[model samples]
Target: MTELFDADPQAAIAAYGTEAISDPLDMLSRLTAAAAHTMEAMGKRVNDIEAIRYENKQGGEQIRGEVKLYMQAMAQTGKFLDMLIKSGFEERKIKLDEQTAGMFVTAMQRVCARLELTPEQTVLVGTVVPEVLRGLEA
Candidate 1:
């Protein structure tokens, strides 16, 4: 149990004889253990961040799919409404000749005169008309 340090204040660390230690491997092993522990902690942190990123990606994809489905449903509803209107006109035995078409167009214009719609919305509604006719045929 020789004291590891000497009373001499000026004694360099090299002057401490290494013979007192039975094995230098113990110091190396401790150093390796500390490094391994630090590496393990860092690996776990990276794994957690990756998992969070994966979840976010999946959630974003799911939201996109839901939005697509909602748009399709809206389109389908619009088509159904258009078909109902078309069928009602057909039930009246009204042929869609140029004159009838003009009259109907004018009537619709008068009906929507008070309400304002953007050109895009009007185009969207117009696009659904053919789909509604197809649906009615089916």
Candidate 2:
């Protein structure tokens, strides 16, 4: 097996060959696999909760009923994703409102001045700040 170096991409490519280059679908497949594994683990947790519920019932103890909350969370997450898809949220180009964007830029400018950032560093921050702020929910 080839020993790959993450820090040195050229060396990693030389060692592992061009097959090391990843495509979107490859990444998506890996993500899907991880999600499936997570779901399986969550299923086991639900089973454990059911066992606890059963034991508490047999012993005439009060059930904590965490499984209901867990199921609700899962259902809510699914509904949220479904709504996002149906609403074409990802298809639209979303951006921060100008007022909020200006406020963020002004704050960052103050931060840059306080930190005494180099002119180039300040410029770099100015360039990326808008995109970064837009990525977050308001």
Candidate 3:
């Protein structure tokens, strides 16, 4: 890059018959222009790399979320998620009262038995069920 910048100004000055132009000033101008171009290129490359990383990260998170959902469906925890939503927790961000919470536990226990899920299987399903139905909307 230095060699290119060093050669260009000399060639330009000779071609334009501008030796009368101060050699130092002309070279300085070319060097500054080359540095600006290099910085612009470097900035673009940095942006491209950042964009790729962001895209890859988003895709990875999405795939992981989907895989967890698949595991939940296999375990029948998808129904639990639906039951939770249908308990009138879908739109309003309201906390469940103690009575409602008890009912929920009872319902969950019934669902577990109905599905023939062992304690370990119930725990495994509880860990992976999608909190919200993101996949369904898609």
lDDT (tens digit, per residue) of candidate 1 on 67-129: 444455555555554554554644443444666877866876665555676778667656776
Per-residue lDDT of model 3, residues 14-114, tens digit only: 56564445654334445545555555555455544423222254455232333443344434444444444565543433343566767867887788889
Q: Candidate 1 has which clashing residue pairs, if any?
A: none
lDDT (0 to 1) per candidate: 0.53, 0.62, 0.54
Can you list the residue pairs that collide in candidate 3?
none
lDDT, residue 108, candidate 1: 62
Encode model 2's per-residue lDDT on 1-138: one tens digit a residue.
233465776887677565554554344445545555555666577777635454454677554455665565566556555555665544532433566767876887789999998889988887787777678856
Assess candidate 2 and give its TM-score to the true structure. Answer: 0.29
How many clashes (backbone N, Cα, C below 3 Å) per candidate? 0, 0, 0
Give candidate 1 misplaced runs (Cα > 4 Å): 1-96
Candidate 3 lDDT score at position 127: 60
Q: What is the C-alpha RMSD of each candidate to the true structure, in Å?
A: 33.8, 18.1, 29.5
Which of the two candidates, 1 or 2, achieves a greater TM-score against the reference? 2
By summed lDDT, the worst window of 10 consecutive residues in model 3 runs over 61-70
